[model samples]
Target: MKDGNLDSIDKRILYYLQQDARRTSSSDIAERLDLSASTVRTRLNKLENSGIVRGYHLDIDYDLAGYPLYTKIICTAPVPDRDSLASQAQEIHGVTAVREIMTGERNVYVNAIGTDHDDLNRISKDLDALGLEIVDEQLIRDEYVCPYHGFIDEGDDPAPDDVDEVETE
Candidate 1:
């Protein structure tokens, strides 16, 4: 389904799933939203079937897991080859994620985690071998994630005030 097809209930289901998909059960969400467990499950199934839910993922702390080095490798690839290059980048060892950016000279971004300098260096070389010119390499300290509160309707309970509203002309 399209973005417009996602109603308030569907969005709230997504919001709660983002919070903690592993621990957040349908019963738990039902209690909060006053929705029935079966209804939540049905909605969740619809979301997954429509490919909106995709898959739940673990938030890993590479530093705590003994891979202390996290890095982002910025690269440029020919516009025509960006998509294929990004898919290939994921096959490289230590490369955790690859993003293909549209409308930019530096079009591909790769995030990698490694045990040390040598491991990161190897990842960089592998990416370069795949025809992605290494524009820059950054030592990443930390990453943060939060659910998109825009999913919830304004008529519902107040959203968290932590997010700053951006005004656009």
Candidate 2:
């Protein structure tokens, strides 16, 4: 998948797997699609090894765990040390994901998880201290999150002290 060598069958396998990670495998998919089990298995293994299918997790109801808020924050750091600046933003609470998005006008974006708008801003200040010329920022106040598509589940929260390195692809 990383080499962009996936065919139509590979994409179909991924679509079905993403739909329901709990009830998918080479044999089951092969039975439905009329493809050989070996083919499905090999394609799946290739996707896994190449990091396209990064990992799997059971979709948990986050409300039951007291994490009720869902929000996103985009940050722009027109600084040279983009990684280091992104690192500083990653130190704040609720800053679950941070990355230097681009090198031009909008250089950084942060996806944060918090219960309130104040919390997002509280985290933004720590990011602002990196000495970057920020062009602008947009806060996604409300939206529907596709649980099946993101990198992490609702329960496997990243701690405030954790450092995250975002990959641009």
Per-residue lDDT of model 1, residues 2-90, tens digit only:
74599888998887787778877999878778989999999999899989988999888889899999999999999988999999999
C-alpha-based local distance difference test score of model 1: 0.86
Best by lDDT: 1
**True-vs-predicted CA distance for residue 143, candidate 1, Å:** 0.4
**What is the number of residue pairs that collide in model 1?**
0
Using all chains and alpha carbons, the TM-scores for the candidates as numbered come to 0.90, 0.63
Stretches of candidate 1 exceeding 4 Å from the true structure: 158-169
lDDT score at residue 154, model 2, on the 0-100 scale: 47
Residue 57, candidate 2: C-alpha displacement in angstroms: 5.5
Q: Estimate the Cα RMSD of every predicted model relative to the unseen true structure.
A: 5.1, 11.3
Backbone clashes under 3 angstroms, per model:
0, 0
